[model samples]
Target: MRAIDLETQVLAAVERIRKGEKTENDLIECKRAWPSNNKARQLAGSLNRAAGDAVIYVIGIDEKDGSIHDTSDTDILDWWSQIVGQFDQVPAEMVRHIDVPISNESVVGIAFSSDRAPYVVKTGSPKPSLEIPIREGTGTRTARRDEVLRMLAPAIRVPAATVLESNFSAVHYPPLASAENAANDYRREESVHAFGTADFFVEHDGRDLVTLPTHAMDGIIEVGDLSFTLNVTPDWFQSETKAPRKEYIDRQREAVLISGPGVVPLRVDVEGLLLSHRKLLETTNSVTVRLHLGILHTSKPLVIEMELNTNPREHQLPEDLNRWSVRGK
Candidate 1:
C-alpha cells in the first residue's frame, strides 16, 4: 500500500515477482510511446477485474536513467484526475492513486480494491467479462476464472477485539550499555578543511573535473602527530570549478579524504569542511593547517573539520583533542 517511485519500486516489484512474493501479472508498465488513453483504459479494465486487490504501477515516462523529464503537455495534476475518472467507471471498486517522486521523475501508483463483486474489463465490441486474468509475469498466463473467483470471495472479516495483544518488551532495543561504553572509552574529536591547490593536475572533465592532490597546497601535512590520512582518493581530486581561472571562492564542489586513530576513514565534500573551519578561519588571520574529511551518506557527503596549529608563538594545545565534541549554543 505504500507509494514508491516507479524506477526503484518497479525493481522491488520485479524482485518480489521473481521471488514469488507477489504475483507478476499484477504489475503493468505504461510507456510514453504508447497511447495514453488506451493504456489508461487497459489499466482501468485490469483494476475492475481484480476489484481492488490489483495494483497498477507506471514507469518509463522518465528517461532510461530514471531522470525526471516533463513529458505531458497537460498539467500533471489534471492528468492524474482524468486517470482516476477513467478507472472510477469500474463497478464496485475503490481506487487509490498516488504520485511518487523518484529522482527527477514522477511515478504513479494505482491500487484498486473490489469489495463487492467480480471485477470486469470492457474491451472493444465485447461486454465486460471475468476471463481476463491479471498477468503475474512476462509470458505468464492471467489468473484463472476460478482463481480469480477465490480471490474475490468474501471472507469473514476478523474483528480487532478478537485479536490477542502481546505485552511490549525492551529486549528488542539496541544495547544502550554497549553504546555508552564505546562513547566513554573512545572519545576523540577531529575536524577537516578543503582548499584548492593550483598544482593539482586534471585527469578528466565531463560533469565534474577529476584532479589530483598536490603536495604543496594539501592541508594534511599541517596536522602534526594527530595521525591522519586521506581515506578516499589519496591522489585524485574531483573539481567543482566549471571555469578553471575563476576567482577561488570556497564552493561546495570540492571533496577530501581523512582518517586518524579511533576515527573511521571517510570522504567528505567541501561544504562540510567549510562549516567546521568557519570558527578557526574567523578567529585567526594566521594560516592554520587542517585535514578535510568527507563523510559519505546514502544521498550526499559531509565534511569533518579538524584544526592543527603548530605555531611556537601561540599556546600549545592538547595533542589528543576530541574533534567530534560540539560547543553548545
Candidate 2:
C-alpha cells in the first residue's frame, strides 16, 4: 500500500478496508470536536484495536453552528502528542506517524503501528481496558477472553478436519454455465474438518462429485482427487507435532507466474503456520493458515506455485460432520 498524496491515501485506505485487506485500523474525520479526556481515550481505544496496524485521518473543514472555522492553532502538534502520551501512563506504549500541513486546514492524518505486543486502553478506575484488533463490521470491539487467548496462542499447523466439517455450496464458472443448473456439475466441496476454513464450494450434480479447493475460491489450489486425503497437523494450534517437514512438488511456473513492470521481488519466510479461527467477523466460519513462501517478484495477478495439504484435524465434534459450530453463526 503506497500513498502518493493525501487524497490517494484516503481512497486507498478505504479501499483496503472494504476489501478486508487492511493490516491496520483506520479512522476518518479528525479534530471536529474539541479535545477532551474522553475523546483522547476513544482515540487510544481505536488505535489499540488495530493490533499495531492502524491509521486515522482528520478530514475536511470544521463547520460548527453553520460557520466555517479555520484552524490556526500552531501548538496543535504538541497538544496531540500530549493526548497520545496518556496511553503510556497505562503501561501501553503507542507509536504513531503524524502528518500535518501549515496550509491545509481541512485535513489531518495520524497513523499508528505498535511494535510491541497487544496494548490496552484504560477506560475507568481500576483500569478496565480493551484489547485492539480491526473489528469486522463496526470497527473494533473489546475482545473477549477467548478471542485474546486465541490470538496470543503459539502458532501450530494442524489438519483441517480437526476443526471443520465436510460440507459446501457450489457455483459454476464461465457465463455459459450461468443458467439455473447449466454446468452445475462443476461442483466443489468445503470442509470444516481442518484448522482454517474456506467458503465457496462447487458441487457436481451428475457424478455427485466435488472439486477440491482451488486458488480461484481462496488461497488453496487443489491438485488431486477429493478421495485423496493427507494426514497433517493444523497450523497455529496446540498440537502434538512440534515441527513438521516441508512438502515440495514440481509446480508449473506458467500456471502461477506473476509478471509486471515496476515490481519488486518480495519473499516471505513463514516459520510456523499462523492460523485463525474467526467467527462473527465474516458471514461464514473461517480458519486461516499462515505459511512462509520464499521471495518472489511483485507482479499483477501474483502467481504462487506450491502443493498444500488438505486434511482433517485430529479432533471431532458432536454436530453433523457437514456443519461445524462457529462464532456469530
Candidate 3:
C-alpha cells in the first residue's frame, strides 16, 4: 500500500477491533494498554502465535466497553523491546505503532509482520523465560513440539527456485555504468542494491494462514539477520561444455547490507569487479546468464534460495565498454 493509504487502512483495522467485530484470528489481536514488565512476558508468545500473519495488536482500548484512550504517549521501542527480546532479532519496520482516533478518544495501535516469527524470542532476563508461545484462542500459551513445527514450517525450505518468477520476491541489479562514463577499473564505492517487496515471499510455512489468491507473499514472513550470496553461470555453446565456468558472485562484491531499523535502503558494492567481469567474457558470449542468489539470515545463517535467468542482458565484454548496459526484472 502507498504511504497515503496506510494510515487509512490502519484506522479501519482499529475500527474493526473497536466494534467488537474482529476475531482473534491469525492476523489480529487486542490489548488494553502497554503492558507492565510482568505482562510483557506474554509479548514474545504473542509474536510466535502470529506466525507469518500480518498481525496487528490494538492497544489502549477498554476490553469490556471497547473504549479508546485520550492519547498514546508510550515509545514504540519500549513495546518493541518486549516483543523482540533482543537486539537486531527483528527490524524496526516490521513493527509499527500509530495513535489512531476513535470517536472522541484515541487508541494506540501496533502492527507486526510475521515474516520473522517462530525464532527464539528472549528478554535476556532469566530462566524459564525462553519458552516459545503460540496463540490458543484469544490467549497465548506455551507451544508444543508439534505446534513449534507448524510455526517453523515456512522458515526451512528443501529447494531453491532455479528460474525466477513473479512471486519469488528479491530483485537486484548493478547500477548504470554507461558508455560515456565507462571505466576499466571498478571503484570500491560502486554497488548493486536488492530491493524486496511484498511480492518476494519468505519460504518457510507450517499450516497455511488465511491468504487470498490476490495476496502477494501471503505466507512468506521475514526471518532475522539477512545477507545474500550470489553465483553466476555463463551460457556455454560451441567452445566446450567440459570447461564451462562458474563464479561465486559475492567474492567480487565488497560488502553486504540489509535494510532494518535506522537502515532504510541498504547497499553493497562489487569487489575487484573489473577482474571478475573480465573472466566472465572469456568463457562465453551473452546468450544468457544464470544467476543463483542465496538469501541467508540470522546470527547462525539459514539460507532461502532464489535462481534467475537474464536474457537479452548486457555483457560487459573486456574488449569494450561502449556497449555495456544492464536491464532485468
Candidate 4:
C-alpha cells in the first residue's frame, strides 16, 4: 500500500469503525488495549494468520462496540516493540502505531508479507520450536505440514534476488524497454519538476516547531494555468550497495497530526510565461509557485520569504532541462 498521512489515515479508519462503515476482515483485527500477558501471544498469532497480506490491528478500540479507551499511560511504540520481539521478529517497518485525538491510546497499522513458508510462535525456554500458525475461523492454530508447503511454494520457484557483480546501468534509471523486458511508463521517463514553498508550523499550546509540508497539509494560491500531480511514486530500482552487518536508525513516523501535510499543485509552469520573453523552453526552467500552508495542518501561522529557498523539488525536472541530460557516457 502507498504511504499515507498516518495520523489522518488512522483517525479516518478509526472513525469508520465507530460509524460502522468499516469492520474487521481476513486481513484486519482490532484490539481494546495494550497487548500484555496472554494478549501479547494472541497478537503474534493474529499476525501469523495474516499470511503475508496487508493486515492491520487497530488497537485501543473495543472490538465489540468500538469504544475509545484512554491511552495516556500506554506508550504505543514501546508496547509495539515489546510485542513484536517477544512473539515473532518482524521488521520495524512492517508494524507501526499512530496516535489519534479520539483517545489517549494510539491505533496500530501493520502491512506484513513474507515469502518464508511458515511464521510461527516461539513457546519455549532455550530450544524454541517453529510451529507454523494458521488461521482457523476467528483464531489461529498450528498449521499442518501440507499447508506450510503450499505457503513456501512461491519462494522455491524463483531465486529471491539476482546478484549483479560487475558493470551496471545508472541505478536511478530503469532497464531497457524491449520485447523481452517491459518498462513502466510512469517510472521510466523523467517527470517534470513541480515547484512550491514550505513553511514551519508550531502548536500554540506550547509545542515543538516543525517543517510543515511533510504532514496534514493544505494549500491554495493564485497562479497561471497549472495542475497538480501526486508525486508519490519512488524509483523501482534498488541500490546495489553491499553492506556488512548494520547500523542504527533514529528516523520515525509521526504519531499524531502534530500535523498532516501533502502536496497540491496550484499552477503549471508552461509556455505562457514571459521567461526571457520567449516560449521556446517553456517547459524547462519554468516555475510553478505553490503555497506551503501551515494553520490548516496545525494550530499555527506562516509567512513567505523569497530569498529563502522557495523551490520545492518534489519531482525531477524534465530530462532536457536537467544539466546531466547530456547523452552518452
The TM-score that candidate 4 achieves is: 0.38
Instruction: Report the poorest 10 consecutive residues by lDDT, candidate 2.
Output: 155-164
Residues forming the 10-long window of minimal summed lDDT in candidate 1:
162-171
What's model 4's lDDT at 237? 30
Rank by lDDT, descending?
3, 4, 1, 2
Task: Give a tens-digit lDDT track for model 2, residues 224-245.
Answer: 2122122221121223566883
> Which is the better candidate, 2 or 3, if ranked by TM-score?
3
Candidate 1 differs from the real structure by a C-alpha RMSD in angstroms, to one decimal, of 23.3
How does each model score on lDDT? 0.35, 0.33, 0.41, 0.40
* Model 3 TM-score, all chains together: 0.40
Pick by lDDT: which candidate is best? 3
- Residue-by-residue lDDT tens digits, candidate 4, 181-240: 434344544223322222222222213223323243333322224433322111123335
Looking at candidate 4, the ten consecutive residues that score lowest on lDDT are 161-170
lDDT of 1 at 257: 24
Clashes of 1: 26
RMSD of each: 23.3, 18.0, 18.4, 18.6
**Tens digit per residue, CA lDDT, model 3, 1-329:** 23333456557766666677764554555567776544443555665665444556667765556766643476767756554444235432344666676677776666665566564545456775565666676666778998777676664222212222321112223444675444544533333222221112222222222111111111121112222332221111233457755421111122222221111111212222233343342332222122223333211122233322223233343333212112225
Best candidate, TM-score: 3
Q: How far in Å is the alpha carbon of 312 misplaced in model 3?
A: 59
